[model samples]
Target: MFIMRNISIMKTFIRRRHIYIDHYDLSSTGISLNEYHQRRHSLINLIRNYIKTEQKQSSYNFTICLPSSTRLFMGPDVAYFPFKQQSDFYYLTGCMQPDALLLLNGNDETFSTNLFLSSCPMNSINDYERWYGPTITDKDKICQIFGIDSVHSIDKLNSFKIPSSSILFYNSQITDDTSTNKKNLIPFLKNFSSSIVCNQLNHFLHSLRSIKSLTEQNLIRHACQLVSKAFIKTIKNCKKNIQNEYLIHARFQYECTKLENTSMAFYPVVAANGRSNILHYQNNNQPINSDDLIMLDGGCLYKQYASDVTRFWPINGRFSSSQQQLYEILLTVQKDLIKYLNSGDKFITRGKLNILTDQYMIKYLREEFILSRTIDDDHAKRIINYLCPTSVSHHLGLDVHDCESISFSEKLESGNVITIEPGLYIPLDCTDVPSIYRGFATRLEDDVLLTDQGCEVLTSMCPKEINDLYRLLDERDNSDID
Candidate 1:
């Protein structure tokens, strides 16, 4: 049985500014080792239920293999990109180090856990100490920290044995493929006889990951709040006098990084003026015009959870008549979508919302896009299709688009966090849209948590209201003028 023990006997090490204690404390990450243990237990039970109900097998042994992410360099002999652990690996074991493996082996009722990590002698002048600095090589420290049955050197992985009849749960997509077969796991399992059953581990893990624990929800909520505040600062920083899109991008980055263990969740979309017509426009180097609308889609990663949001405003701190009309319409539509999600009319799902998005867009396009003329149903459909071609929402969590394998058609359950992003894009060259709306693009996004009571908009603190956005920039503009 795996039990927490005193860490007095474990060794400690330090490299540069980081310290490795005998006991690994994960409090800063806002998740507990006990939660990780429960995750593993849940996965095991999930597998067990599958075998009993679907397979109808009385007895079976199974091994689940999860490998830590490996480091990758930018180019030949260059510095590596920041190391990001595979989400599923981090989910099961709170071990944050690279080049490690976790194995859960046992029969239907119980299992034993083993963690394999790269190790070097404590006092030796080996590669670990010379080039990379100190690593956690102490087995007892790791065992107690991660609540595993035992820890061993990764080099000994091939020597370990499991029941020949054991079902093997492994997903190569989630493991480091750059590693060799012996080190990577998919090939290591091949060493066993063909009688060893192979299963796609992602199936079980994604099902579990789709639901957010209260701890996870808090992490995401914090991330959303951070991004919301950062957006306000970014808008204020760039108002009136800012010249280029990259300056806006840099300002947002600076604001986000002021907090520890936080960074942009993805390369932000900082589109100015006509560039906004291109959805996913990340080449944030174009010069901003005084009267042009600036569209920003960005988020932050707090701990490992992600929050996504999008907002649009006039670069001059005041929207033009056309920009104001289009922005107000889209903002209203986005708010209505969020309200519909929480309406509890029926069991809702992303798939249904996706379909409803088109309907809603068409309705708005016909009723509001043109004040001088009323568009018929066929004309409105054509205009909506040409202007907006993206889905309204997707699930959000560890990865920006978390649980992608989980179908959008699946019901929206409590403890699930998702984003509602409705966007409108009108290219200058496209004649389908009215001339006044041409070359304008904008999206309003918010992270939402589905609870039994109702859906909570996690990013509401981020100002998406037209008047609020105006006030933020107007105050900055006034201060600069004074």
Candidate 2:
């Protein structure tokens, strides 16, 4: 969930200090400029619908500030990131400028959606454009680009007086969310008139983002294709020493951004040997030993949407007997889970129980003799967490782990983009574990889009079948032969 995107740039430092960017690209594809107008109207309508159902009808105004990371301080002349518009704000306003704000006011008949541009430190209106690149300065042109009804300067945001009774529907996720990695928005609200109250609209935004629009799905699918191409390159280039963990990581980055031209969605997990057992293991510096069955978890960003996929490969172009044994069983479990998904049963639901229980994986593990016990008893079931440490699925979109507020247990809905990953971690050092499956760690992750009849595996082009992987790697090993 906390996968970091590390893109290659010509340079990102000043003479004084080095700077790291969180996200360097904010391009939007598939989503047309005209579609933003529809989104804005839908969001405002959602707000109005929410207020109408409230115990008491309330008058309110919406306020969303661009994420502070948009123009992070690096050095005197450096900015780390390329002005990534905040997800929620962009969903509603489609504006990409830094330090800007969008206000949807019900009290004013002037305009429902008002854009407030933050002035520069030296009173230069082109502050963001000066650092990022050329940007439209004409107020009307800016409005035309963003599909906003009105535009104003942030200097006048607080001056527009509102009565004490009106509420501010705020999209600042939380005052205590330290993950933003920059200043939170709560303190900035002190500038607002004390008469107005700020109520968090975080849940409303989450609910909206859970269901992907057609444009968002297309963007995510494009990212998935890029991921598949990058993965294929990594497979074809594998070597004993030259293609270690970092090589695989570099291949993914290069193929996605350099060849296909996209951005790394997160820091890739190029885990080999025992490293795969450590979930979220990102120290991609490990060697590709003769026996290491490497686990690669990498994807790229396309048009502000994310693709996440996980694959396992044997460095020597063949899986060991133990590797084959475990991979076969695990692959079956993953397929069964996916089959169930396509059967109209909610992803993690089995009548009333979560799918991770002995209901599916545990039963299969025991049937294949992979697990010592089936986790049938209460005690065995309690240890289910140890077997598969990560959840079966998660919401995926602009953020790899999108729709944080929604519980995965709920029934799957159409337009929901989620990830289905089933992984196994067996400790090699533990003598209690059977030698056949010892030190075995395998995770098969696929990005899934829930559709009307079933689901679509968006990242399917990257082959995962044991036989398929073996053939591909063998072909690659001899690709240069005459």
Candidate 3:
């Protein structure tokens, strides 16, 4: 169920027969053009409310400008990375082309959204289109697809008019200051007076993005499900008992990509043995030791939504005593954090969740390791902090670390997606614990969605319990022997 549209250059408007994607579908992403319009409408209402409350202005005009990412080259005419649209721009307009700009002009309660796209050269053999294929350039077609008010060629932006006194809401951080794309959009901003009240749009945009719509929630759920299945497949592959970090990483990628419309969200951390002690270790080239525990922190993107998950398992399909002990402690800490969030009376923010996790980690560590009672609460906290220096939770969505502009102090409400990860890294040379635990690290991470009823773990399909993990490996071993 895909819509195929024919796009053509000016010279061969009638002769061209190449087809291009008009929009995404349920198989890829279920987001529709109307949803994009709704997002822009929400932004307009947010700005209007701010004007009424803060400025107390009966009526006012405003212009919000957002820019898309630019194409980057690695060497001579070779693009280094794939073109991913800027998140904020894609959220409002659903337009993924680079070097585009979105302009929202409004007065009182009504607003008009405009998209400025770069037009291709009008020659016989379009080099860009010849190599990369035709893009949606027709103004009417784009307006119909994105549900914007009007569409204009990017060159005309310099002449586009806006009220000089209108409030300017633009996020400077959306693109690099040195980028040519950003520089191109600067002239459009000059139309507004210097005295115009300038506000950062990311804070408001992120506030809306923090609460996922029903469609967004489903997309993220699908993303999490894909990653979970991929993890299981990778774990089973370890039955061979001769896999390396690189092979495990490749196995996970192959499993995820074999599915429809899925890609890795980020470079995975495939750490083995002492390498697990280094947080965010991504040099996935070391050989696996039969006695060493493996830590894999990887996830994939279904559509544009991302899933971030981490799991620890033994390379030999059985956990050692020390490995089991450390893994159980971390797993308990992760479970407690989720359980507390679900059962707690007061709404909890990320900061509060982090503090609670620290408390749980210290309590478990002290009880299991038999730390001296003489250690004060602050001392225990410091020790836990030293062990796991990364944040316990972060917002997850379009980007793995989604909605960065939204502060962690904000209370998590229904429809919000965040990761619950708690880990401990004990150095090989450390004297703080028994030698068996040293040089070992264990972590359990899951994608969670906050809801009115309770928090749901989206990555629950992947087994974390020791018994369940053992069952998976046992099956693998039995099958290999058979």
Give the number of the best model, judged by TM-score.
3
Please write out the lDDT profile of model 3 over residues 1-482, one tens digit for every residue: 12233343443653232222323332234797667778888888888888888888877898888887766778887975645667888788666677778889888967788887655533432554676675554567667777778887676787888865788888867544555555567676666657465558988898999899999999999999999988888787765466578988888888887887688888898898879787768899998877778888998987778999999887777887877888888898998999987895466899888888889888887888734457899887887788888889999988889899877788898999999999888888866677778888767899999998879999999989998888777777544311
Position 71, candidate 3: lDDT: 68
Model 3 is weakest, by summed lDDT over 10 consecutive residues, at 17-26
Arrange candidates, best lDDT first.
3, 1, 2
TM-score of each: 0.89, 0.83, 0.91
Whole-model alpha-carbon lDDT for candidate 2: 0.67
Task: Tell me the tens digit of each residue's lDDT in model 1 across 1-482.
Answer: 12323332232332221323222466766888789889999999998887788777879888888887765678976846555777888899877767778888989777999987754434333444666664554567767877899887676677788876777778857544774324546556775546545457887888899899999999999999999988888887776768899998988888887876698789899998779777778899998878878888998899988999998888777888878877777887888888887787568989887777777777666576452246566776666777778888888998898988788778888999999888888888877666887788888899999998779999999998878987898778544311
Q: Let me know the TM-score candidate 2 reaches against the reference structure.
A: 0.83
Q: Compose the digit string of candidate 2's lDDT tens values, residues 1-482.
A: 22332222212212112111112222344566767777666656666666666624655554433333245657987776534556777777655566666666663222366777654432233444466455455677666666677777565655654444455566454444443222324444554545344355756777788788887888888888889878877777776555468877877677778744477787889888879888878989877777678888888887678899999988877887777877877788778777877776644432232454245666766666655673455654544556667776778887777867676556667888888787878777745347777788878888988898888999888899977787778778565421
C-alpha RMSD (angstroms) for model 3: 5.6
Query: How well does model 1 score by local distance difference test?
Result: 0.78
- Candidate 1, TM-score vs. the true structure? 0.89
Which regions of candidate 3 fall more than 4 Å away from where they truly are? 1-28, 121-127, 477-482
